[model samples]
Target: MTVYAVVNTKGGVGKTTIAVHLATMLARAGQALLIDGDPQGSAASWAAWRRDGEFSPSPTTTVLLGKAVFNEGKALSQGFDNVVVDAGGRDNGGLRSALLLAQRAVIPVGASNLDAAAMTDLLTVVELAKDYNPDLDVRVLLNRVDPRTKDTAEMLEWLAEQNLAVMDARVCERVAFRRAIGEGATVQEINKKDQAAVSEIEALFKEITQ
Candidate 1:
C-alpha cells in the first residue's frame, strides 16, 4: 500500500500535473486511487475530463481536502495498489494531512530563483510533518526546466546548498505537458508523440514507484 503525494507550498509548480500523470500510470499498472487534496480541485477537474473523454485505465479520483486527506483517504485505500494525492498550493491542513499520509512526497521545483527560494517555507512545513511521520521519504523534483538555459545548473547549485537530494529525472518545459494535462491526458495519451515528454515523465514514474 504505497501512497505518493505531489506537494508544494507555492502555486504554479505543476503539482496537479505530476500527481495526475503519476496516478494514471499507476492505475495502468494496477489499482490506484488519486485524491485531490487541494481546495482548487484541479485533480478532480482532470478526472472529470478524463471521464468524458473515456481514457482507458483511469484511476479512481476523489476530492478529499483538509484532514479528510488523512482520515478518509486512509479508509478509502482498501484494495488499491497505490494512492497519489495532489496537495494544494499553500500551508493548509490538506497539505499537512497529505504529508502525514504519504509514504513518499514529491515536491516539484520550478526553474527560477524565486521558485527555489520558496522551498524554505515549504520544507519548513515538511519538517514539521516529519515530527509525526518520521519515515516520510521526501523527494525534490525539478520541473519546467529549460534545457537550453543555464537555469537548470543554477537550480542544482541552489538545491545542493539546501542539501536535499534531487531526482535524476527532470521534466523539461514543453507544450506537450500543458496540452495533455489540459485535456485530462498524459503525454503518452496525446495524439502527437512527444517522445521527450513521455520519456521524462516515465522516468519519473519509475524512479518514484521502483
Candidate 2:
C-alpha cells in the first residue's frame, strides 16, 4: 500500500479537503482507507454525514482516531492500495507516527502570507520526520492559489529559491471544492469533467508516486 499523509502545522489549510479528494480519487481507481487523526474530527464528521445519506458515496469507510493510533493505521493499510491520512496540526504524536509510517508526505500550502510564513514551522516538522526516515520524500502542494495574484508568483519563486520540491499542479480556490464536504463528494465526483481539479490531483499523485 502507498501511504501518504496530508499534513500542515497550520490549520484551515485545506488538509482535510485534499485528503478526502485524494482518497476518493484513488478509491475510484481501487481500494483506499482514510485515517483521520485530527482532534477536530473533521473527516470523521464528514463520514458521519455520508453515512446519514447527507452526502454522496454514502457509507464510505473512514476511521477517526486520536494521536498515537499509528499501529492501528499501519495494520489497516496492509492490504490497501492507498492509505490517505489526515494528521492533526501541531506536535501531535499521531502526526509524528504518521510521518514515520508514510512513504511520502505532502504539505499543502494556501496562497496567503500567513500560510506562507507557516511553511517554516512545517519545515521543522519535516526535519523532525527526517530524523526517523532520511529517505522520506516530502513535497509541497500549493492549494487555494489565486493565479491572478502576485502572491502566487512571489511565493512560487521564493519556494524555488529555497530549493523546495513543489507539485506542478496548483489547487485553485473554487466554489466546487468549498461545497464538496457538505455534499460528501469530491470535485471530480461532482463533475468528472472538472479538468482543473482532475489535473491538479493527478499531477500531485504522479509527483508523489514517482
Candidate 3:
C-alpha cells in the first residue's frame, strides 16, 4: 500500500484537514485508511462526525487511532490501497514515527512569514528522517492561500528558493473548507456552491498521486 503523511511542526497549518480530505479523495479510487497520529485526535473526530451522519458515510475509508501508530499503521495498511496519517503539529515522536512509515510526506505551510519561518525546523526533521526512509518523497503544500493577496505571491517565491520540493498545486482560502469540516463533509460531498473548492481538492489529489 502507498502511505502518505500530512505533517507539519507548527499547529493550525491544516495538516488534519489535508489528511482527512486526501484520504476521502483516495477512497474514490479504492480502499483507503486514515491513521490519526495526533494526540489532539482531529482526524478521528472527523471520522466520528461522518459516522454520526453529520455527512454522507465514507464507506471506502477506514480510520484507526493509536499512540503507537507507526508499526500498527504499516501492518494495517496491507489491507488497503492507500494509508494517510495525520501526524501532530509538533517536533515530537509522532511526527518522526509517521515519517518512518510514509512513502510521501506533505508539509502544509500557510502564506505568512511565521509559517515560512516554521518550515526550517520542520524541514530539518524531514531531512533527518530521510536518512532512514531514503525513498520518502517530501513536498511542501501551500495552504490557505489567497491569490488576490501579495502574500501569496511572496510565499510562492520564498518556497521556490527553499531546498525542499514544493507542489505546484495550492489550496486557496475558502469558506467551503471550514463549512465542510464543521459539518463533517468532504469537498466532494458538499453542495454545488462549493464546487470550486471541490475542484481544487481534486486537482491536488491528481497532482499528488500522478
Candidate 4:
C-alpha cells in the first residue's frame, strides 16, 4: 500500500481538507483507506459527515489513536491501494506514529509568511521521520492559493530554495471548495463539471500516484 501522511505544524493550513479530499480522490480511483490521527478527530468527523448524510461518495475512514495505529499498519500490509493519514501538529505521539507508518509525508501550506514559518517545523518532523524510514518522500502542497497573483510563483520559488519537493498542482482559493466541504461533499461529487477544480485535483492525484 502507498501510505501518505497529511501533516503541518500550522493550524488552519488546510491539512484536513487535503487529507479528506485526497482520500476521496484515491477511493474514486480505486480501493483505499484513511486514518484519522488527530485527537480532534477531524477526519473521523468527516467520515461521519457521510454517515449522517452530510456527505456523498464518502471514502472508508477509521479514527485511530495510540496503539490503534498498529492495527492500521496490519491493514496496510494486507492490501490497499493507498492509505492516507490525517495527522496532528507538533510531535504528538499520534503524529509520530503516523509518520513511522507513512512512506511519504505531505505538508500543506497556505500562501502566507506565517504559514511558511509553521511549515519549517513540519519539515523538521519530516527529517525526523526519515531517520526511521530512509526512503520517506517528503513533499509540499500549496493550498488555498490565489492562482492569479504573483505570490504563487514567489511561493513556489521560495519552496524550491528551501529544498523541498513541491507538486505542480495548486488548489486555488475557491468558493466551491468551501461550499462543497460545508455540505459534506467531495468536489468531484459536488461539481463534477467544474473543469478548473477537476483539473487541479486530477493533477495532484496523478502526481502523487505516479
Candidate 5:
C-alpha cells in the first residue's frame, strides 16, 4: 500500500480538505484509510459527517486519529490499499511522525506571498525527513488559486523557480469547494453546477497518483 501525508506548516492552507478529498477519491477503487494526525480532528469530523449521512455517495473510507497511529503506519498499510494522513498545521511531533512514514508528502500552499514564505520552514522539515527516508516524494500543491489574478500568475512563476517539485494541476478558488466541504460532501458528490470543481480535483488526483 502507498501512504501519503497532506501537510502544511501554516493553518488555513486546506490540508484537511486535500486529505479528505484524496482519500475519498482513492476509496472509489478500493479500501482507503485516512489518519487524522491533527489534534483539531477536522478530518475525523468529516468522516463522522459522512457516517451520519450528511453526504450522498458516502466515502468508503476509514479514519483513525492520534499520533500513535503514526508509529503503526506499516501495520495499517498492510490492511488498506491507500493511507492518507492529515497532519496538523504546524511544526510538531505529529507532523514529523507522519512525514517519516509517508511515501509522499503533499504540501499545499496558497497563492499569496505569506503562503510562499511560510513554506521555508516546512521545506526544512522535509529535508530533515530525507535523512531517514531518502525515497520520499515531496510535492507542492497550489491551492486556493484564482487564475485571473495577477498574483496567482506570479506565484506560479515563482514556484517554477523553486527547487521543490510542484504539481501541474492547481486547485482554483471556487465556492463549490467551500460548499461541498461545509456540507461534508466530496466534490464528486456535488451537484452538476459544480462540475468544474469536481474536474479540478480529479485532475489533481490523476497527476499526483500517476
Candidate 6:
C-alpha cells in the first residue's frame, strides 16, 4: 500500500537501522518487503541475522541497486502491502531511483553539527528528484538525539524555513539499537523491558505510514 524510502547523503545517520526497524514493524501489520539499495548491504545483513536467529514473521527482503532500484522497486512493490527501501549513504543512482517511486521519503539526520549542515546538500538532491516524484512526502527524522538537549531545535527550525516537515517522532541514541541490530533484532525482540527504544521505533513506523 506504501513505499518508504530512507535516505541521506551522509553516512552514520542510522539510515539502514531505521529502515530495517520500520520494515519489521510494517511486516507485522501487513505483507511487507524491504529493498536494500545500498552497496554496503547492511540492511541485507540484518535480514540474514534475523533469519538466523529464527525470528518469526520477518519482512521479505532483497537487494536492488542503481537504476534497477527504480525499475524493479516498483515491480516488487506490487506483491507486498508495503515496501521499505534503504538507499545508500550518498546521492547516487540508487537513492535517485528510490525517490522516483517512494510514497514517503524519510531523511534521517543525526544530532550533530556536521550531520545537520549536510541537510541542505541532501535536500538539494531531493528537490531535483521532486520533478520525477512530485507526490513524494518528505520528512526529516531527528535520529540519535541527545536526551538532555534534544539539541536539534536550531537545525529543525532552519529546515522548517525551507518548508520541510521534521517528523514529530525522534530517536535517541541508545545501546539497545546497536546491540539489537548487531544480532539482527529489534529492541523489542532483544529486550521487552526496553520500552523507550521500542516505543521510539514504533512511533517512527506510525509517523512514516500516517
Best by lDDT: 1
TM-score of every model versus the real structure: 0.97, 0.88, 0.92, 0.88, 0.91, 0.95
Clashing pairs in 1: none
Candidate 2 per-residue lDDT, tens place, 82-148, comes to 8888887843677787888888888888877787787787777789889988988888889988888
Ranking by TM-score: 1, 6, 3, 5, 4, 2
Predicted candidate 4 versus true structure: per-residue lDDT over 66-154, tens digit per residue? 54564565565456678888886733666777778888878888887677666676677678878887898888889889867777777
Residue 85 alpha-carbon offset, candidate 5, angstroms = 0.5
**Per-model C-alpha RMSD:** 1.0, 2.5, 2.1, 2.3, 2.0, 1.3
Among all windows of ten consecutive residues in candidate 5, which has the lowest summed lDDT? Answer: 56-65
- Pick by TM-score: 3 or 5, better one: 3
Candidate closest to the true structure, highest TM-score:
1
Residues 76-165 of candidate 1 have per-residue lDDT tens digits of: 998799999999975389999999999999999997989988888888999999999999999999999988999889999988888777
What overall lDDT goes with each candidate model? Answer: 0.91, 0.76, 0.81, 0.76, 0.81, 0.88
With candidate 2 superimposed using the best TM-score fit, by how many Å does residue 44's alpha carbon deviate from the native? Answer: 1.4
Task: Compare candidates 1 and 6 on TM-score and give the better one.
Answer: 1
Q: What's the lDDT for residue 127 in model 2?
A: 91
Model 5 CA lDDT for position 1: 79
Misplaced by over 4 Å in model 3 are: 54-67
What's the distance in Å from true for residue 115, model 2? 1.2
Better of 1 and 4 by TM-score: 1
lDDT of 3 by residue, 122-160 (tens): 888888999999999989899998788799778878888
Question: Higher-TM-score candidate among 1 and 3?
Answer: 1
Query: Cα miss at 171, model 3 (Å)?
Result: 0.7
Ranking by lDDT: 1, 6, 3, 5, 2, 4
